[model samples]
Target chain A: DQQVKQNSPSLSVQEGRISILNCDYTNSMFDYFLWYKKYPAEGPTFLISISSIKDKNEDGRFTVFLNKSAKHLSLHIVPSQPGDSAVYFCAASARGAGKSTFGDGTTLTVKP
Target chain B: DTAVSQTPKYLVTQMGNDKSIKCEQNLGHDTMYWYKQDSKKFLKIMFSYNNKELIINETVPNRFSPKSPDKAHLNLHINSLELGDSAVYFCASSQPDRDGGYTFGSGTRLTVV
Candidate 1:
């Protein structure tokens, strides 16, 4: 079963605009949600994360919003730049799980 | 310097052949893992080791085996390779108790013909 899901396979946005990526999860036991960005041939790099206790977390240009009631989370990038074009993957983990389950991933293209 | 590195970036082999992928991490983390990314781009955990001890072993096939000689290295070996086994394998490491994200290697593309 897919515990985490990214409905949008791809997204395109103009540079200097805002880009939003959404993710959903079926497991309510998950308390931690994370987002990772991946280039064409490189492994995924961690971007930002939010704990279940917090509704939102911001890191400079990136922000993550979590809704425990809806079992959903979103990653938002403001003033998106061309360098931000990459695949974004959403993952979740529960306490003592020892590992995180990843979504199928969403490709984001920030046009110049 | 690269934190996590895996060898044999691309491996193309015939069916029934045995192969191995080596991984090493310089971050000095106590936990290491092996994840497989299928054609659908779903990253699934295969095995996890902490301080050279097997911690988590997902329901992977018996043909696949993971070995960790130390805390910083983990290797995967496959016997009787099949076309269905073709995928990109990634190695990652993390501090077992820390909340930070895991560091992943570039990944190895294994193609079984």
Candidate 2:
């Protein structure tokens, strides 16, 4: 069973516009959530994350909001740039699990 | 220097042949993991090791074996490779307790002809 799910397979947004990516999880035990961005051939790089205790976390132009009650999370990039186009994955990890479960990933295309 | 590195970026071999993928991490992280990205682009965890100790083994085939010589390295060996084994394999390291997230290798693309 997939504990983490990114329902949208792809997304497109104009440059300088807001881009939002959504993710949902089924496991209530997951306490930490992370977002990673991956290019065509390279591996995924960490983007942003939020703890179960926190509702929102921001870093520069990227922000992550988590809702524990809904078992959902989202990544928001304000004024999306063309360089932001890539596959975004949402991963969730539970306490003492020692490993994180990843979603199928959503490909984001920022048109310039 | 690369935090996590995997050798043989691309491997193409005939079915029934045996091949191995080597991975090493310069980072002194205590946890290492192997993940496979299939044609569908779903990254699935194959195995996870903590300080050379096997911690998590998914429902992967028995033909696939993972060896951790130390905390800094994790290698994957496949016996009698099948056509279905073709995919990109990624090596990742993380400090689970620190919540620092994971660092992944560029990935090794394997194609079984």
Candidate 3:
């Protein structure tokens, strides 16, 4: 069973525009959600995360919004740059689970 | 310096051959994990070790085993390799699964013909 899902296989955005990636989960027990970005041939790097207690968390130009009721979360990057072009993965974890489950990932191509 | 490192960035072998992949982390994490990403890009957890103790076993086949000689090194051994086993294996470490997102190695691409 896929606990976390990223419906979009790919997304394209022009430079300086906003890029948003979405993820949905079926596990209600998840209390923490995280976002990671991966470049070709490289392992994923942590981006931002949000706790179940908060509806939103922001770091620099990246923001993560969570809706516990809908079991959904999104990552937003404003003023997107070409350097941001890469695959983005959304992962979720629950307390006491001791491991996080990752979504398949979405390829984000930020055009220059 | 690479926080998490794995040996054999690329491995190609014949079916029924046995092989091992090694992993090491220098992030001072007590918990380590192995994840497999298949051709379809599905990431699945295979095993996890905390303080050199086995914690999570995801119902993998018996032919596959994970060993952790210490808190920082975890190795995966596979017997009778199969074509279906071809994929990219990644090693990751975290203070604890819940408190951290995990630091992953570049990955090892394994292919069986």
Name the candidate that leads on DockQ: 1
Question: At residue A101, what lDDT does model 3 achieve?
Answer: 96
DockQ for every model, please: 0.84, 0.81, 0.73
lDDT of 2 by residue, B1-113 (tens): 88899988999999999999999999899999999999988889999999999999999999999999999999999999999999999999988684669999999999999
lDDT of 3 by residue, B1-113 (tens): 99999998999999999999999999999999999999979778999999999999998998899999999999999999999999999999998745558899999999999
The CAPRI quality class of candidate 3 comes to: medium
Candidate with the greatest lDDT versus the true structure: 1
lDDT string, candidate 2, A1-112, tens digits: 8899999999999999999999999999999999999998899999998999999999999999999999999999998999999999999998888888999999999999
lDDT of 1 by residue, A3-112 (tens): 99999999999999999999999998999999999998889999998999999999999999999999999999998999999999999999898999999999999999
State candidate 2's DockQ: 0.81
Q: What is the total number of backbone clashes in candidate 2?
A: 0
How far residue A73's Cα lies from its native spot in candidate 1, in Å, is 0.2
Query: Which residue pairs overlap in candidate 2's backbone?
Result: none
Off by over 4 Å in 3: none
What candidate 2 gets wrong by more than 4 Å, as runs, is none
The backbone clash count of each candidate, in order, is 0, 0, 0
